[model samples]
Target: MLNIGVIGAGRMGLNHSRNLRQLDTIKLAGVYDILPEKATAYANEFGAKIYQSPEELINAKDIGLIIITSPTYCHIEALRIALDAHKPIFCEKPLCRTQEELDELIPLITNYDNFFALGFVRRYSPNFAKMKEVVDSGELGKLLCGEIRCLHGRYVRMHGDWFADYDKCGGVMLDMLAHHVDLQNHLIGEAESIYAQSFMLNQNEDELPFDYVSATARFKNGFISNIQCSWLRNAPSDTEMTICGDKASITFSDSKGLLLTKGGKTEKIPVDEAALNIHKIQGGMYAEEMAYIVDAVINGKKPLAGAKEAIDAMTFCFGMMTSAETGELVKF
Candidate 1:
């Protein structure tokens, strides 16, 4: 078994632990969190040991891989430890909070060929994978332009909540929109230029903060995408992406299966709804993502969303944030 050590016993860490149990080849070896109760609870429930610190987990002889599901602020330190130990890593994304961290991180990992995967869960979702396959297979013909819309209900949190802090979570752009940004880059190409704007909609003393942003990006492959995302106080959560090509168009949603429009007709492309629903309820795309990483490490195959891809996706996101603040188009 490929024993995996997890840092952070929060929701994401819990999800990863559960999914790791479901895999026959992977074992949840140990867990660590700043909150002793949290780590103890997860270890007890999952039948794993509780580590005294992240250093212990990373250095554990049984752990062949380390999953960093810790908070954003702690990701860098955990990753540093894992890299230094030469352990394979699976880190939840927006890999690091700022470009300076990225600068320090990129050089550190470039010379090492250890297995490192980031959590861009959408890449593992079957529906989005199908969409990517169609777009890349040329079945949709030459890519023209695309649009992505992501929305979430304002989860109420206090001022001290890390999610509400722009510096910690990087607001919706880094926290939420990073998914679509990665998807956009995955489907089209690297962003060559970007223009973006945002409105900090609701800021109340009693309730959590919220933001809405819209960005336009031109890819080096000559495709353009208009992306919008929001953290709202009174709205249903939904996400949609439509990629238009010269011959046809492909659109998908979390609730709806893929839809292909061609020759004046549209049809739903079939997907395994029952299996997808089970994965969603269990760990959603995260479960699938973990499985893929496990398989990669076992078989010596490279992961699709490695450190470079993670950096590229975050680079695009930071560019958008810079554009939003400066009110100028930022270049990749």
Candidate 2:
């Protein structure tokens, strides 16, 4: 069994631990967090060792792999520590929140000796996979412009949480839209330029923090995408994406499976949700993702989403933020 240590005992950390346990070849070696008290539940539930610090957990002899699920701001330091130890890593998305972190991280990630995977879990989702298959099959002919819509309710985890802080979370664009941005890059093509606008991450005293952003991207492969994401009050959480081509168009949703359209006729493509997500847990994509990373560690193979994709996705999303801030289009 491959022993995995985790940093950050927050929701994502615990979520990954639970899913890692579902795989027989994986062991929950240990976990660490700045707040030791927050990690007791993880230690007790998984019988994982409670580590004193991130340095300790990552450097443990028993840990063959490290998974960083820490908050966005905290990711860079832990990532560096893991790299120094030469351990294979599986870090959750939005690899780093700012330009400085990216500058320092890019060189290390590219030169790391061991496999490094980023958690763009949506890549492993069934509906999105089916969408890619149809798009690549050429039944859609020449791919054209597309649109991605990601909407969410206001930030509910408010009680002075880091997520409410724009500096820490990078708002909805960096935190939530990274997933769809990666999908757009993976399914569509490389983005050549982007123009975007947003609320600039403003919040009133004692009010829940919220943000909304819309970005238009022109791809190098001669296609365009309108990407929108939001965290607003009284809004129902939903995600939808559609890509149109000369022959047909395909649309997919987190809750609605997939659809194919041609000549004014639409067809629903069947997806095996239960079979695809056997664990049937929340963020079910993480289950397959955890297992895949373990295999990559064992075989010395690259993950479907690795350092290159992580950096590329972050570049595209961050460019959108820069455009929103400067009121200008960002070109790659």
Kindly list the per-residue Cα lDDT of model 2 for residues 248-317, writing each as its tens digit: 9999876676988899998899987765665444456778777667777887888989888988899997
Runs in model 1 lying further than 4 Å from the true structure: 200-207, 272-284
| Per-residue accuracy of model 1 over 174-209 as CA lDDT, tens digit each | 888878888878888778999989863344666668
Model 1 superposed RMSD (Cα): 2.5
Strongest candidate by lDDT? 2
* TM-score, prediction 1: 0.92
Model 2 pairs whose backbones collide: none
TM for every model, in the order presented, reads 0.92, 0.94
lDDT of each: 0.84, 0.85
